[model samples]
Target chain A: MIDVLYFAWLRERIGAPKEAVESQAATVADLVEELKSHSEAHALAFSDMTSVRVAVDQELTDMSAPIKGAREVAFFPPMTGG
Target chain B: MGVRVQSAPFDMGAEVQAFTKAATGAGAIVTFSGVVRDEGGTLASMEIEHYPGMTEKALEAIRQDAMARWSLTDALVIHRFGPLKPGEQIMMVATASRHRADAFQAAEFLMDYLKSRAPFWKKERGADGASWVAAKDADEDALKRW
Candidate 1:
C-alpha cells in the first residue's frame, strides 16, 4: 500500500488530505494515470498537469521518476511556501 | 537543519540565533523572511493553508537541494499556516556558509523554489470577502529563470 497525500487547493478539490492506495505503478507518471482514472474528483484535480507537483518518498521529483517500492506519493499545487 | 510548518508566529532573532548555534565552522548566515502584505489595500486578512505532511517533506527536499547546490553547512525553513494579519511573518529561510555568496544565493534559490514549487495555498480576505489567490504567471516564469 502506498500513502498518497494531497495539499493546498488539491486537497480542497479532492476533499481529502490523504489516502492509501494499492497500485502497480512503475513510475510517478504511471501512478498519476492510475489516479486520473480512480474517480471524477481525481480526474478534475489532476486534469491540468501543469498546475500540479509530485513528490515520491518525500523528495520532489519529476513524473518520470520511479515509484516502484515507494512508500509515499504526494500531489499538490506549485509550492508557495517561502 | 531545521524545518517547521506551524501556525504560530516565529521570532527572527531567535531563529537566526538557533541556526548559528547549531552550525559548526560557519562564518556567514543569510536569512530571508516573507511578510504578509495588504496588497493594494484590498486584502484585510490572509488565510494560509497547507498539506500537513507533504508541506514538511517538500521543504526538506528544498533544503537538501540547496545544500547540494551550495557550499552551505546548515539551513532552516519555517512556514506558518492559518489566518494571519498583515505584516506578520509568513515564512523564513536561513542558510549558513563560510562565504557570503553561497549563503545569499542559496537562500534566494530556496525562496524561489518554495514560491514556485511548494504546495501552500493562500486565501485573501478583503472587503469583497475571501477568495483563493490565483497562481501567477510571473511566479512560474520566475522558476524558469532558475
Candidate 2:
C-alpha cells in the first residue's frame, strides 16, 4: 500500500487530502489510471493529465517515473511560489 | 541557512536585518519579497497551499544550490502558506555574499527555482470567484539561464 495526496483544487475536487491504496501499478501514470477508476471525483480531478503534476517520495518527477515502493505520492497543479 | 515554510506572516525588515548581522564576512546582501497581487482590482485574497513535507525539502535544495553556486556566506528563504490579502508579503528570499554580483545573482536564482520547483500552489479569490493560478511557461524557461 502507498499513500496518495492531493492539493489545491485537486484536493477540493477529490474531496480528500490523502489516502492509501494497494496497487500493482508500476509507474505513476499507471497508479493515476487505477485511481481514476476508483471514483468519479478522482476521474474528474485527473481528467486532464496536463493540468496535473506528480511527485513521488517528495521529488518532482514525470508520470512515467516508477513508484514501486514510494512512501508518498502527491498530485497538484504547477507551483506558483517565489 | 536554509528554507522555512510557515503559515504565520514574517517581517521582511527584521528578517533582512537579522540575516545581515549573522552573515559575518559578507560584503553584500540582497533580499526580495513576493506580495499577493490583485491585478483586476477585485481580488479579495489569495489562498496558498503546499505539501507539508515536500515544501521544506524542495526549497532547501534550492537554497543549497544557490549558496554553493555563488559561494554565498549565507542564504535564507521564508514562504507563507494560507490566506493572504493583496499587497501582503507572501514570501521572501535573502542572500549574503562577499560580492554584490554573487549576492544578486543568487537571489534571482533562488526566486526562479522557487517559482516553479517548490510545491506551493496559489488560488486567487475575487469578488466574482476563486481560481487556481496557472504556472507560466516563462517561469520554467527562466531556469535555463542558469
Candidate 3:
C-alpha cells in the first residue's frame, strides 16, 4: 500500500489529509487517474492537473514519473508558503 | 533545522537570537521574513489555509532541496496559517553557511521555492467579501530562475 497525502483546498474538498491505497499505477499520472475515479470529491480535488503538483517520497516530481516501489505520494496545489 | 507551521505570530528577534546561539562553525546567517501587505489599502486581511500533514511534508522537501543545492549548514522555515491581519508576519526563513554568498543565495532560493512550490492557498478578505487568490504566472516564472 502507498500512502497518499492531500493538501490545502484539495484536503478541504476531499475531507481528509492522508490515506493508504492499493494501486496498479505505473506513473504519477496513472495514479491520479485512479484516484479521480474513486469519488466525486477526489475528482473535484484533482480536476485540473496544471494547478496541482505531485511529489514522490518527499521530492517534487512530474506526473509522468514512475511510482513503482514508492512508499509515499503527495498531491498539493501551487505552494504559497514562504 | 527547525520547521514550524503555526498560527501564532513569531518574534524575529527572539528567533534569530536562538538560531545564532546554536551556531558553531557557521559564519553567516541570512534571514527573510514575509509580511501581509495592503497595496493602497486595498486589502484588509488575509486568510491562509493549509493541509496539515501534506503542508509540513512539502515544506520539509523544499528545505531539503535547498540544503542539497547549497553549501548551507542549517536552515529554518516558519510559516503561519489561519487569519492574519495586515503587517502580520506570514513566514520566515533562516539559513546558515560558512560564507555570506551561500547563506544569502540559499535563503532566497528557499523563499522562491516556498512561494511557488508549497501547497498553501490564500484567500483575501476585503470589504467586498472573500475571494481566493489566483496563482500568479509570475510566481511560476520566478521558480525557473533557480
Candidate 4:
C-alpha cells in the first residue's frame, strides 16, 4: 500500500485529500492508469495529463519514473506559488 | 541557510534585520517579499495549499542551488500557507553576498524557482468565485534563463 495524495483542484474534484492504494504498478504512468480506473472523479480529474503534475516520494518526477518503492505519490496542478 | 514553511505571518523588517546581522561578512543583502495583490478589488482572499514534507524539501533544494550558483554568504526563504487576506505577505526570500550583483541575482533566482518548482498551489477568491491560479507559461520559460 502506498499513500496517494491530491491537492488543490484535484482534491476538490476527487473529494478527498489522500488515500491508500494497493497496487503493483511499475512506473508512475502505470500507477496513474490504475488510479484512473478507481472512480468517475478520478477519471475526470486525471483525464487531461497536461493539466496534472505528479510527484513520487515527495520529489518532482515524470510519469515514466519508476515507483517500485515509493511510499507516497502526489498529484496536483502546476504550482503557482511565489 | 534557512528555509521555513508555515501558516503564521512573519515580520518582514525584523527578518531582514536579523538575517543581515547574522551574516557578519556580507556586504550586500537583497530581500524580496510577495504580497497578496487585490487585483484591482476583484480579489477577496487567497488560499495557499502545499505539500507538507515536500514543500520544505523543495525549498531547501532551491536555496542550496542558489547558494551553489552564486557567491553568497547566507540565504533565507520563508513561505506562508493557508487563507490570507489581500495585501498580506505571502512569502519572502533574502540573499546575502559580498557584492550587490550576486545578492540581486540570487534573490531573483530564488523567486523564480519558488514560483514554479515549489509545491505550493494558490487559489484566488474574487468577486465571481474561487479559482485555482493557473501556472503561467512565462514562469516555466523563465527558468530556462538560469
Best by DockQ: 4
Tens digits of lDDT, candidate 1, B98-130: 999999999988888888666688888999887
Clashes of each: 3, 0, 1, 0
For model 3, how does the per-residue alpha-carbon lDDT over A18-64 read when each residue is reduced to its tens digit?
Answer: 89999999999999999999999999988888888888987778999
TM-score top scorer: 4
Ranking by TM-score: 4, 2, 1, 3
Deviating ranges (above 4 Å) for candidate 1: A22-26, B18-27, B71-73, B140-146
TM-score-superior candidate, 2 or 3: 2
DockQ in order: 0.50, 0.90, 0.49, 0.94
lDDT of 3: 0.86
| Candidate 4: segments with Cα more than 4 A from true spot | none
Which pairs of residues clash in candidate 3, taking residues 3 or more apart in a chain or in different chains?
A79-B118
Every candidate's lDDT: 0.86, 0.93, 0.86, 0.95
Model 4 chain B weakest 10-residue run by lDDT: B124-133
Q: List the residue pairs that clash in candidate 4.
A: none
Expressed as tens digits, the lDDT of each residue in B9-111 for candidate 2 is: 9999999999999999999999999988878688999999999989999999999899779979999999999999999999999999998999999999999
Q: What is the per-residue lDDT of model 3 for residues B4-104, given as tens digits with 9 covering 90 to 100?
A: 99999999999988888786789999999999988568788999987666568878888999999999888999999999988899999999999999999
Model 1 lDDT per residue over A1-81, tens place: 999988777887888989999999999899989988989999999999997888888777888999988998988776665
**Error at B11, model 4, angstroms:** 0.6
Backbone clash tally (model 3): 1
- After superposition, candidate 2 runs with Cα above 4 Å error: none
lDDT tens digits, residues B111-144, model 4? 9999999999999998899999999999999999
Cα lDDT over the full model 1 = 0.86
